[model samples]
Target: MVQLYNNGAYLLNGTEIIEDNSEANAKLATKLGANVISKDEAATGTIAYGILEKHNTSGNMDKLKIKFDKLTSHDITFVGIIQTARASGLEKFPVPYVLTNCHNSLCAVGGTINEDDHMFGLTSAKKYGGIYVPPHQAVIHQYAREMLAGGGKMILGSDSHTRYGALGTMAMGEGGPELVKQLLSKTYDINMPKVVGVYLTGKPQKGVGPQDVALAIIGEVFANGYVNNKVMEFVGDGVANLSADFRIGIDVMTTETTCLSSIWKTDDTIKEFYEIHGRKEEYKELNPAHITYYDGMIYVDLSKIKPMIAMPFHPSNTYTIEELNANLMDILADCEKKALVSLGGAVDFKLRDKVRNGKLYVEQGIIAGCAGGGFENICEASDILNGASIGSDEFTLSVYPASTPIYMELVKNGCVAKLMGAGAIVKTAFCGPCFGAGDTPSHNAFSIRHSTRNFPNREGSKLQNGQISSVALMDARSIAATAANKGYLTAATDIDVEFTNPKYFFDQTIYENRVFDSKGVADSSVEIKFGPNIKDWPEMPGLTDNLLIKVVSEIHDPVTTTDELIPSGETSSYRSNPIGLAEFTLSRKDPEYVGKAKAVQAAEMARRENKSLQEALPEIDVIINKIKDNYSDVNNINTGIGSVIFAVKPGDGSAREQAASCQRVLGGWANIANEYATKRYRSNLINWGMLPFIIAKEELPFQNGDYLFIPEIKKAVEEKQSEMKAYVVGNSLKEFTLKLGELTDDERTIILKGCLINFYKG
Candidate 1:
């Protein structure tokens, strides 16, 4: 259903695609009555380039220093972002900041710490002239869509699903430090990114929801890195066919394709969406110029898209419902094999056991979070399950409206009653299901969710506790169909049901009654609240002349997500405290990571205190002496001691800063990876003063506990040297080269200054 263009293409008047091949270029030049334009000039006509140009503060288009119109964060991230900004002499928010409490809204954990965070958010909003949305008020992105998004505006959010492109706004989900930069009135620095055209054509068949189209696109692009870090601009006839909500559903999931951000051609559908949300002025007609060019194109035929399912372990592991049902056993076996890789044999993960009499059965179905919680999805789900009962035998269903307004509308339209009558529970707006914070199923249970992700532990199973469950991502229609069938897997297309596509009525009063908006007014007299669990960041030392880092953990996993780096679930309660949350670093992936890192941290602490490294760790003297034999500058005073982790690919999933910050807090000085999965992850590492080193060779030069000594490491970063030499000092000194990818001057300085905090402090 999806076709990827390997070559550049031109959109002729936003109607036809002309590949940039020799013959096609000739025809296009003749049609335009002009010679072939420069790729840079052609790019200016694209919707993405237009939006980016509006936000770019730098005079040069090659190097963008972006200033977003607004910034957003949920509770899990806002506390840390604001805390970092405050430490860097932040007096007030320079731009509009919205802090939504949806991730950690469940106050059941940590005994009132969650609500305390909410209160802190409110007080910080008051003191800093920001906005705060209380618990159950709205999830981050939905609220942004309903209120914050506007045509051609750029918004930065801490949550990874921060995409509102369907509304003609270019929204990006980045690490909290990026937002911190925006709060400080600094620019988001990046090289000009490639823009990919997502050209959609034929209309979607009945019962195939937006999630199906999204999963199909994600499946095609994710593994191969087709759209990695590129802007995906949705264009073509199919854009006009889909409603605003459907377009949003597909747009939000573009984060799964590893794209930087997204925007789409807006029409009356989007104009109506703005009018419905009471922001008619925000609506603007946005489309590509007559001869816009894209670096690449992804042509999708919406008609051929089948009811889809992304099987357990990842959103990219996709299969159509028909294919999965036909080849059940084989697919189950393949999933089990993939589970072995993802789970590291921690628990016996079996989806085959869930299959009963050649039919797969799931324990629960959830249509929640930003992806599935939209009004149209929920209404269609309620329609599919109308007059049907979700049998009480080991099966349950739950629905969560994205915002209170959506919930109110559902209640008003009787969709909530239909869902409740069919034995489904409806909850308020919370992002717990998308992460691991809420709706944890029993051990070995399989849940089908219409959430954003299905990554390991994202379904709330603690592999450390030997409690493992699985989540398969599907559309809300199919999830509801499965629930109607009492959890036996069924696609919505198989069961013929008329959908009642009800109109969405925005209720601004719900937010007006609950949300705290500062209206751009800061009150310095207001006191900032600090809970007992909330703590400032630990002191970090700048890069030393010579550096020594122990390989504390070695992960061979092809990709490591942020959830595995620090985990989500109950550990989110400690996110406000750096050192407190660092205790859970690699808790699920490597249970001994904290202890091993702490041991190395002790040696670093000893070095900082002018104590002998030999006295702290006797083994360090042997390595130091061995390194001293080869190099004269390898001494405790000049060389700092820390730990590092080697992963094949790190920073795949969430934009959470703790992925790198947690490592930094636990005495990590560097990360060795073949490649980083996302830009946000590498930025997190740089912002936290960690060296993002890349080793080119397939064979590892060092093992866990081996010491790598890099002489003149500080000077290397300062000089913008791409290649640096490192020696593995143990039984024998083996030297290898590590490469640091292209870094901006500010990024290099951030590393030299220890971190963003230290950089600002100086």
Candidate 2:
């Protein structure tokens, strides 16, 4: 029985309850002896509060804008941003920025391609007077956790799980456009988000993991969108029962819930976490008011959570290990059905092959990244696999701790030794497994992972390349159980074992020895490294009077993940090189996408070179001349030409800026979507100066190879208009209205400026 932290509650001392206040706590808490929120309060408290206050749009929002230091992205994304910002006239970086090189840590593909991105980052960090985190020292989240996170502060990353709320920071995972707003010194605007209390009452059972609890919560709230876009504030007795490491393990996975951010009621355990990390000064006891009122609540009894698994496609697709064992065929069939939506007929994908002798057998097990690589989680996995070999068969296990600190602690406690004795490969902190650059499996392999995502092609396989693999989300305990059985799927609950909570000793010496901390200094003498593959961003033209987009492809998948757009594995290293990486765009989903996009782009290039449209692409001339007959204003004028793809759902994983840039490189202009997957991907589009247009879910009027024209696009974007008329050039021009979602003031300018990079091109 998985007990959730039930939110529907009245504060009680065993049954004696107290009711909430009269008005919205955000408003009421500030009035009459409390701090009136005033919708627009700036920093009245600390640096963190100042950042939060600026974004609180209800009151005097403008006055709070001056506080932020700056915003940043990395090599995996900055090229597009810099290109766009430069198009808008970027002169110099406004604030202290950073460009890290952790994503393309695997340098196996395209030869020196990953290093090129790192060199580009080093140069950009120097040129822009920002920081640069070299590769392999830490994963993105772990590095951010150690260096960037501050109490009560706010940071928006292009990565979807840009949350670090446990450290008293109000971090958000948003698209690139939001970061552009910050880099341009513009405030982020949003309606105040509803805060939901996740009240945990009981302690967790043994052999369970943070991934299990997170999966359990996701299962409860995901399907119905109960906690979507809401802040989950964890509180209550169960919070006291869980150790700081355990709490953090669960906290890291909260981003998968699609929530804005999360916070836990800070206690001595939290304080100790800061002290152990050698930042005791940053510790502060954070708690809601005695009469706090949340919009809603989720109740979790930690003791009830058991070994869990989120089958393929989504984190929300969850069931227990026992449930999978009890009805293997039925769930396996369900997964196959889901594959139709996820894989989109790309390959024959299935989970049924894992079954043998009435039990499931997994080919691989991994414990890595922010969600799984904690000291406690690794120690537990080590204990479970104590003297058991993973076997000489296809079954294998690997473990990666979050940081050097955690890794050093594991070694100090002999957890590394134990894992090694048990045949588990312990590696450094790299996000490759989570994004598929490492530990690639054979075709039709099934892997259980404790990493962040298991999106299609995220298992280090390429469908177009005739390689395919799949993964299931699971805790180390259960993964170990399956490993111990030499590949038979087994639940931790099936075998009882004692879990000894061991104390961790932090050794910062590793980071102190290896990490180069600039401590916020500007060194002009440092020559930026510009590798051959890392070229300047293509000159993006400003938004024209109208947009002519050729629909190159249409994706009907419920969601189109970034991995599908610009796959994982080898391609991860080329994010910094725009044109080089663009060649791989839509390479996996539609192998012919690049050629098709390039064909349309050739027309745009010809136009740039002052060649006649009729002379370049005779087919485009016929379509445009037909449109000119209807709308006299339509002429072969100075306009940008690009290709567009309509996906039912897109922007699902990784905040790599390239997802949108590749489209821009291929002469793409706008994306017509039913809905976007995460905030980060949408922001990536807007920051790249692409029009994020949406049409009704059922009313997709345009098809591939069709031309769409939207007149007065820049004006329409400037003045917020949900509906804008777009023309499809076919037999006769069929006009359809597409909707542009809400955009903040800075966001509008970034689009007008062609991107944040151009905007900052001072």
Candidate 3:
């Protein structure tokens, strides 16, 4: 259903695609009557380039320094972002900021911790001239879509699925430090990213929803890294075929493809979306120029797409439901094998046991979060289950509308009644299901979800405790179909049901009555509320002349998600407190990571206090003596001690800064990986003042518990050296090289100062 172009291509008059070959220039010239633009000029003709150009303030296209039009964060992230900004001398919000309490809406964990965060958000909005959406009102992205998204505008959010391209807004989801930068009136610095054209044609089939199309695209591109760190600009005649919610369902899931951001060519469909939301003036016509070029193109034929599923452990492990059922045992066996790698044998994960009578059975189904909670997806799901019952079985179904307004409309249009009548429990607006906070299944149970990710432990199973469950991603229609069957996995196509597509009506009164809008007015006399659990960040030391890093953990997983780096769900309650949250760092993956890192941190603490490092950490004497063999000047005063972790490719999922900051606060100084999975993760490491060390993908020079010494590490970073030498403090000090990727000058300063908070303190 998806075809990837191997090379650059040209779009003529937005109607045709001509591959960049020998005849490309001639074809373009023929179409434009002897007028053909250069590749560089045509590159500027994309919708992505235009939106970026409008926001870029660096005056140089090669390097972008962007100041976004707005900023947003959810409860799990806003507290920390505001705390960081407050520490960095934030007087007032430089741009419009919205704090939505959806991630931690369920105040069931850690007592009053979640509600205290809500109060903090409300007070911070009043004190700093921002906006605050109360819990159960709306999830972050849905609220932004209904209010904040504007055509030809740029928005930055703290959640990874922060895409609004279908609304003509170029929004990026980065770690909280980036939002803090905006709060401090600093610019977001990055190199100009490549733009890829996602040219869609043909309409989707009756049973195929946007999730099917999204999974199809993700399955094709995620493994090969075709659109990594690049913008996916959707452009084609098929754009006119989908409704606003259909396009949104596909756009929000672009985060799964590892793309930087996405933008769509807007038409009357998108304009109507704005008008429905009561922001008609924000709608602006956006389209690529007549002659536009893309570095690559992904051609998607929606009509050919089938009802799809991404098997347990990842969103990229995709197959059609028909294909899966025909070869149930084989696919289940393969998924079990993959689970061994993902779970590390912590629990006995078996999917074959879920098969009954040659058909796969799932225990739970969820249609929630930004991807599935849209009105159209839920309406179609309600239609598919108009008069059917979910039955009293192991299978349970729950639906959560993305926003209160959607819930109101669903109630108004009787979709809620139909869903409730069929035994589906409808909840308020919350992102818990998407990130492991809700709907946890029993051990060995299988779940079918319409959420964004299906990663390990992302379904709320604690593998370290010998408990595990798995989730398979499907569309809302398929999930509802499965629920209607009570337990048996079924595709919407197998059940012949007429969909009563209903019109949506937006209601703004709910938000107006419940939400706290500062109206861009700050009250200097207002006191910022502080919860007892909230804690300030611990002091961090700047980079020393030399470094000694102990490799505490070694992971060979092809890719390590942020969830592995620092888990979500229950741990989200500790997010506002830095040191308290660090205790859970790598708790699920390594279990011993925190203890090992703390031992290394103790040596650094001794060094900082001018105490005997040998007495504090008994084993440090031998390693320091061996390091002294090469450089006699290396001493406790000139060298720093810390820990590191080596993974094949780390930081794949989530834009949460804690993935890197948790490591930082626990005495981690560097990360050794073959490569990083996403730009946002690398940025998180940099913002946290951790060295993003890149080792070649060959056999390692050191193993876990090996102390590696890097002399003059600070000097190398200051000199902008691409590569550095490191020695394993063993019998003979085995040597190896580590590479540092591109870093801006400001980034170098942040490293030198220890972190963004320190950089701004100066």
Tens-digit lDDT track of model 2 for 1-762: 433333323332221122243443433434424543332231122223334664564475433343333354654666556544545554456666656555676677777767776776666566656667777667767767666666665666667777777776677766555566665555666545556667787878778888899899988876565666677777777778888777777888888777877776777887887787788887777665444455556777788888899998778889998888899999999999988877767788878877888888889999998888888888888777787778889899988888777888788888899888888899987777888888877899999999888888888888886677988999878887777778788877776566666798877777778555455555666665766676777877677677788999888877788888888677766665678889999888887889988888888878777787766677898777777787668654645677888998788666677788788877778788998776667777877878888888786788888898777787788787778998998888888889988887766776887765665663
**What does the lDDT read for residue 100 in candidate 1?**
94
Evaluated at residue 28, the lDDT of candidate 1 is 76
Report the number of clashing residue pairs per model: 0, 45, 0
**The candidate that achieves the highest lDDT relative to the unseen native structure:** 3
Cand. 3 TM to true fold: 0.99
**Global CA lDDT computed for model 2:** 0.73
Residue 200 in candidate 3, Cα distance off native in Å: 0.6
| Global CA lDDT computed for model 1 | 0.93
Residue-level lDDT of model 3, residues 1-762, one tens digit each, is 899998989988888999998988788778886688899999999999999998999999899999999999999999999999999999999889999999999998999999999999999999999999999999999999999999999999999999999999999999999999999999999899999999999999897899999999999999999999999999999999999999999999999999999999999988888988888999989999999999999999988999999998899999999999999999999999998899898888899998888888899999998999999999999998899999998999999999999999999999999999999999999898888999999888898999999998888989888889889999999998998898799999899999888888998898899999998999978898999988888887899999999999999989999999999989999999999999999988999999999999999999999999988899999988888788889987999999999999999989999999999999999999999999999999999899999999788999999999998999999999999999999977898999989999999989988999999999
Output the lDDT of residue 94, model 2: 66
Instruction: Tell me how far the alpha carbon of residue 72 in candidate 3 is from the true structure, in angstroms, after superposition.
Output: 0.3
Estimated TM-score per prediction? 0.99, 0.90, 0.99
**lDDT over C-alpha atoms for residue 593 of model 3:** 97
